[model samples]
Target: MRTQQFSRTARSLVAAACALTCLAAEAAAIKIQSRDPAGFGFNDPTPAAPVGGNTGTTLGEQRMNVYRYVADIWEKNLDSDVEIVVSAGWEPLACTATSATLGSAAAWNVWRDFENGKPGTWYPQALANKLAGENLSNGQPDDGTGYGNVDIKTQFNINLGQPNCLAGSGFYLGLDGNAGDAVNFAATLLHELGHGLGFSVVSVQTSTGYRLNASATAYSPTGLPSIWEGFMYDNTARKSWLEMTATERRQSAINPLQLAWTGPNAVAGAAITLAPLPVVKATSPAGAVPTTPYTASSFGPAVPRSGKLGVLATITAQAGELGPGCSPFDAANAAAVRGKVPIINRGGCTFAEKVKNAQNAGAVGVVLANNVAGSFAPGGADPTVTIPSVGVLQEDGERLKAAVAAAKAYGSRTQPGAVTASFAIDPNRKAGADLAGRPLLYTPNPLIGGSSVSHWDVSAVPNLLMEPNISDDLTLSVSPPKDLTLPLLKDLGW
Candidate 1:
């Protein structure tokens, strides 16, 4: 995290260029180089007509679509009036040239090798050379050009990899429609481009000063200290503008680091649509004798003593600390006494096994909490399991455990006992409903109806290996947008 400032010599050079350019009256140009190889899948067949329909859209078109999506968000949210100029061909040049070397496969390969081994290592000389190839900027061998430029390069590469692009960042996007498909291109691109647009700021914080590194910046978006994390954890504090509190003010503020793009009165733009979760209905007999006594301390108030409550019974198997084998008359029995909610510890077997066990015993609902210390944020329930279940924290589990202990200490005198409990389920709880209508928003779970976060939820993993529950997978990581702001509307003439 070394902070490298622009050198005096570079400043002098820029001054000289400005003086010379004044006489020529030349405008500084923002160039976009679109590299489309012949016969590549991204090329449009007609070239003249707008690319539409499934077949006519090429790989490049998909990538462009993603860019448009991002641009739309930036314009509506950030109010940036910048114009984008797109150029497509074999190779297009943009700026200053500092290196003498032309194109060389060996050079590209060597650079790739160095980059792959350690993604974060910054080589000023190599970067200056690479920039020379693109004519973006100029630098000397020992001048310490730094990574601000490298951040831009990494962003460009990510854009190229659009759909089936490469895993990390090295693999170039292929026009071969066979390798990369257009599925999820819009969301994935928006997420990655977010990295390109100053989302990396959260990674380097200061006790006193800023931490700097090109890789740190490049890796920032998909990494943590994410805007989403900040908003979720700091909801009450208003520390992040992305939360509901700052939603209106975000649009007027120009700073990219602020949470919301506009203030509370501003529109949140289109809401991010999500898929729906699967529905599971309760199915069990309607009446059974109480295996345990009913009490408010033993079960929640929602549980009923008769009807759907007592008729349903669920059986489960507990292993590890609770000991192994199935328990037919344990937690499920407690739930049946009141007719609807059963609590179980999470360990020993798969969620499917636990659900099947409960189903066999005729229970209608299940609540499973972590057996370990801390919160029960272990992950999600198995998607295939049909029973509706939610997780409780370890503290809740401990409360039940303590009640059981007290019941044993009291002997059999206590009717229904302190350990009595019931099962309860809700069929219509929607995911992300907490912040669904707000300007700044996020989904806590990946699958709409499923219980966990999917690999595709974030933009860092290899596109090919993405799957549901990838958030729990150690291989994947998430990068969140940092403080994002839009300048005062008047400044941008809107």
Candidate 2:
């Protein structure tokens, strides 16, 4: 989508740091420009009882209250003199019985060559105006969309939580952090707003690896970079996105765990907020692998450091089973897996389903092997899955299968087991970060549009508010020690 273009109005502004310092002296004013018609979106008149520190008596009023509340949080964290306007509304976005698009937001415009902006680098409209100390969004004719004066554009799903539309997962518009089974509307809003305010790539296409031209209306071979790209460092290319070519940036987008944010503020915040990563340590069967990093499943209990070690049992397909362990194990397979940790292949069922099957079979823990070649974090909610579960790379799974087969063939594999493993935390390395402690950006093998390079990697411990998926345990805080959103904004010159 093209960012709305505006004719830049001349303004005298100080240098970058001094401009930011001057703006940081006062609180910002965030204005929500309602895009919906009357009696709709923020104007709906449906009656609603007060709940969770929100006093609005109508549905739309409650929604607006949450918007203003989240806006106040960002306003306090950001510094600006000109009113930061966000064009927002509620609409029927994409939804299904189990999943839905909660909302989407991005900069309504991008600017470059401004008084305080880095030369040839794009800045989001709101931040651009703040740095330049003038409203560049004004004095533009409505290109028929009525978004000429807006700095950001956002929308949410109005039909969320309804039947057939992510049924039972509607937005909970409460100030309290008790979302229960419902989605926390406040946290979701805060995350999307973070993107609009500056936590997003302005005009780079992940699929094609092409950057947007100065006008941002089409892809260009020689395109200007955004301020966000200045911090993206690719270990494979040994260069930052600012120093790499378009093809190199495209290749780095799928480099997985090699693409990291180099922003000092965010890197520092990660040291405070992130924890050591969880891994599987093969402790038995001499010559077994030492340590293998794994992605913890969202469905099961966290992998503990000790007390759960056992033989690494490999599952065989049984009669009536979908795949390896897609269904309940038979007598023989269950017996072999009993009191052991079963390594199941991914597919034919949900991660929760496989882990639940393992738990029911008396397994101490579960290791999920990827069907594909790259890394992935499994996500699903299952309270019955009490066992610790983690996913390993495809190559690791193949090695485990070979080792199990070879060991079981020999008599020495009987007593202490062919392979024994347990989960452990590598205190030397941080979760979701590189060796230097820089937080990894989301860069899966196949690109996920709007999620691939724009958000933090999902493996982050403590579950950041901007990690593509929303965790129910998120709080209102957006600064360091609790979150890294504000620090990243600071890196973007907020």
Best by lDDT: 2
RMSD of each: 16.1, 3.1
TM-score of each: 0.38, 0.92
Q: How does each model score on lDDT?
A: 0.29, 0.82
State which candidate has the highest TM-score.
2
Writing each residue's lDDT as its tens digit, candidate 1 over 325-408 gives: 124345545455233445566676554455445545555555555554322223323444444444444455445444444444
Candidate 2: clashing residue pairs, number? 0
* Model 2 Cα lDDT, one tens digit per residue, 179-215: 8888999999999999998898777887777788877
Model 2, residue 135: distance off in Å is 1.2
Lowest-lDDT window of 10 residues in candidate 1? 101-110
Which pairs clash in model 2?
none
Instruction: Give the TM-score (vs. native) of candidate 2.
Output: 0.92
